[model samples]
Target chain A: MTILFEIKKNYELQKVTWKEKDILVNTDCGVKQIRIWKDRALLDWHVRWRDEVGKNSLAVADRMIRTSEGKPWVDMGSEYLTLHDYVEGTHERSGHEKRWGLLIGNMLQAGLELQEEFSSVTKEDHYSFDACLAAIHKLSKEYNELVSVKNSLPEANKRLNLAMELKKASSHVPLPLFDSDTHMNNGGQIFNILFYRGSDDYPEHGYQPLRRLLTEWLKECGPYSLRKLLTCINEHFSLEREQGYLLLAEILTPWELQDCVVQLKNEELAHIVSYVKSFEQDWDFNRILLHCFTDWMDDKRKRVAL
Target chain B: MSHSNETVNYGPILFQYDLYPEKIEEVGKVKKVISRRGTFALKETSLNEEEASWFTHVIHRLSEIGYHQIVPLYPTKYGDYTVQYGNRTYYLMPWFAGGDRFGLTREEAIIEEIGKIHFLTLKEQDFSPEVVDHSFQYLMQRWESRQLEMERFAEESERMPYMSPFELTYLSHFHHMMRMAEDAKRRLKDWYDACHSEKRYRSVLCHGKLSRNHLLYSHHGEPHLLNFEKAVLDTPVRDLAVFFRKAVHLSNWTKEEGGRLLSLYQRHIPLLDEEKSLLVSYISYPEPLFHSVDLYRHQRERYSQIEFVHRLEKRISAMRHIRDFCDLILTPPPPQPLDTNINTDHI
Candidate 1:
């Protein structure tokens, strides 16, 4: 289980001599550490190596490896790893019923440790949670490689699959609600987290057409039709607890409708409605929602104004 | 105004005056030499009130910033520019004792020194938009007008008496070169237009005509720049390019010397790729050599045919080599930093 650190020609890491297994790269602002394991790709931890308290040494190592070539570096502190897993858990539980509980639990445990670390660092300097998440994803491959070197092949494969699934699921969820003030105080961790989630969940296939329609409609008809749609969903869901499922079925054609019931209950529907309402003024959010639900809309109905 | 014995007397100096002489003195330390044009005066003095005020301000300002080329000479209360003689207009300030004109020994050094001056002046000066635009436009107009004149000259060369048999042969060959120059001028106009339209006007103080005569050397072997009358705010590279054209083309200097001078310029100014390209193309224009040819033709009896042809050939070759030199300048070899004190002979 040997980890191989492949060095690119332009990699700044190559500019300095390092020990075969342990290397430290120092930039003007901070430091990064590289650890080569016996059975995985190189592991990098980056932190604010500047003279500051609560700077995660691991974060420095990650930054060192990620920004080795002077490209933008990521700082995936502990908090993001936990939030990433929490979002993945919510998605996993809602979308599919597999034995993802253990994986989610492990992620939450990691997230809690990250939260603790984040709290300590935020006391001094502020960082965004979204930025933290981005840093985590950026450094995930390297961290996974490090883990792979320590684990047996089958075990490592299982963890790799779980990590990949979590990455995929977390990438599809809408932006989460976090205290912007608190996030700003902690190096914008909250904003970073929300941004990461929003960008990741951005629908792929129908985005452009939906965006065009949304732009035209917003300009031509304003937010009247969007508010009506949300109101319709909310009223219908309030009438009957089970009507949420029925509303989903009504909105989607027979062939398009999923037979499986939504994992989120009426209360969750209310939460989602509130969440969707919060984004009524955001063009990007409206576009994403429209793109996500375009297939579910009735063809007979006039296209949502916008 | 009139002189006794056909000689002019101005204060202590006296000299015989000549309008059209059978033979002129080739060697002399005569206290005064005169021409019918005027009583020739020589001396060391400051500029007149108007000129002095201008030089004092320009030179003093430039000198403060390490530019020490043209120093001010103290003037008498009467405000004359020179002192040794009383007639001819001249300024004497240390005389640049050791320097010779462009073709003298240490030719490369003199060329490079000019390049250094060109680089420095260009780096320091700030020019007004009116000055930059006027000079650039003037040159462009002159080039356009010259193109038409050249075409007429080509046409007249074929007519009787306008061109002698030998002249016709020379004209036929010269026409080819002239046409090349015409094409170059057309291209230069376009380049100038592009530079202007791009708003790439970084004017520098320039010694408008940087010829061998204006560049001098001090006794200590340091290069000294002189003559500031033609100084203006314009493209500094024009000065370097003109010097280059005169040295390599008109003066028939070796390519090795040209290379040395160019290297010195590069070492001093580090020309940008675009500047190098513009310079190369500007020098390639046959207009300068064409004017030189016209001047030589008027003095043809005193010039040798073989020497004239040789000089023309050098200029044409220089014109052709301009593109290669431009490419060389623009795509300079990557910097290889060396330890200042390292001896690399073993390696």
Candidate 2:
């Protein structure tokens, strides 16, 4: 039988059709979206995290719809499939600023609650500034003839040195024990944040292909909006002193420039120049972002001291 | 009693079960949720993290041990037996419509279900002198303190120039209540001595709150137990005492019916002699009567003198029934008259 037929048999649904990539199933309760997963560990983590979110009255993620036998997933031969409430909405970026913060805060709280179960399935954040510096140096040597790549080398080295110092200073700080999903921001566009009428006030913290949500938000949300987001997050889950140090170290690292340098290949000279130009521009933007983080932390420390 | 506004309040919890409520109706401690999915009984209670785990474990453990007469909890789409919403924990079960068995049949069904559970989980505990001594001393100290409080109250009432109706009623039955208290202490000592001598004790999963109200009959007349939130592993006498004490409050209850119910339960697992004494000890305690007086003393302004007197009288009457029941059961039948001629010929 076809996968749709299998879904119908397992979920006891009558009408199930493919809505592009996702399967739209008409359930007795409401319309639902069916998504399939190939990895068992990831599927288990998703089920657990979503279940925790659902239980805690937190509207941070879409809960998995169980099959007739009260299972979160229906097993096929090679893959597993799950259903979720099919929310109809559009992604809006301009408004709902506080709502976005509240959503992320709740997500972090939920993640912290399921830390034990989550830490088993996911890896912690491992950042190395030296790796980025070495990759940049090799790229600069490879493209020495290109003036853009050549000019950006000295500034890139200086930023790496600053990142190294911050990393060394914060070496005593430990990474958070909870599962770290550095992919909360829906890229820079934040398109996964759906807004529909009669929908929940908080939207789902969807998946992202971007490397780190905080770095991306620094480039996209500007310093002020990012501060608002962190402030709201801290309201729900107070950031510890050690966690603040680690976060500051992360902000100091030029992850965007590192990502660009790593992605550079033996493409045409034009692409290399454009890549170097973009990397330079992102590196400058990160400087401002670093300042924003330090400023927020210093202000918070002073307020606490007072 | 359809509550549309309140239905919105319960939406998040019901949504966990994929249930869209068309209406919500409050029934005692539970909410009857009428939904497109089906009708469900949603029980909202408060249980901290540890208590929640224990409560769910008890429910699953009961089923694992082949006790299926319980009202089963429906797992949410997330496969959790309970949904924690704010400080309250909510669980869903298929609503069992009330049947006509509201009287003796219901009580008998409750007793039988309790007996079945006790029989299934009954275990002989390794004799621990520390546990036995602590239990005996703790209970002895608490019962004595309560008994002393009642005595003081009676003395204070006697000293009054003009006694209230509640005071008069309490003073009248004060002697009988004290006698029952002493009798309970004596039985408790006997139980302790028996256990110490035998170096043995048995424990079963006692339904901490046993009442006819906690049992419901299905349409097919099969009774299903509910409210195991307070279930614990304790002496079998704990449950029997709780049940019989409440049973005596029924206007039609007799020592014979109580005896018959005990026999019905005994058919599943017979109570040992010490256990019987413990049961009598738990039942004979005049704690309930003292509660009536304490209520009158503390909250006299809240309730009228007639109300207090009426409550005290009702409890006194119930205690009388318990006393009679205990006397009838604890007493052995008189020795039958011997036929001397027949006995001599046999010898």
- What TM-score, over all chains together, does every model reach? 0.39, 0.80
lDDT of 2 by residue, B21-108 (tens): 7888899999999876679899998986677778889999999999998999998766788877668888999899976664558778
Question: Per-residue lDDT for B154 in model 2?
Answer: 88
Q: Per-residue CA lDDT of candidate 1, range B189-302, in tens?
A: 555665555545555666666766655566555556665645666566777776766665545455555666777767767665446646765776676557646755577786
True contacts kept of 1: 0.00
Clashes of each: 45, 0
The interface RMSD values of the models, given in order, are 40.2, 6.3
Query: Which residue pairs in candidate 2 have backbone atoms (N, alpha carbon, C) closer than 3 angstroms, thus clashing?
Result: none
lDDT of 2 at B42: 97
DockQ of each: 0.00, 0.37
The parts of candidate 2 lying over 4 Å away from their true place are A20-22, A90-238, A259-306, B1-3, B100-104, B151-163, B333-347
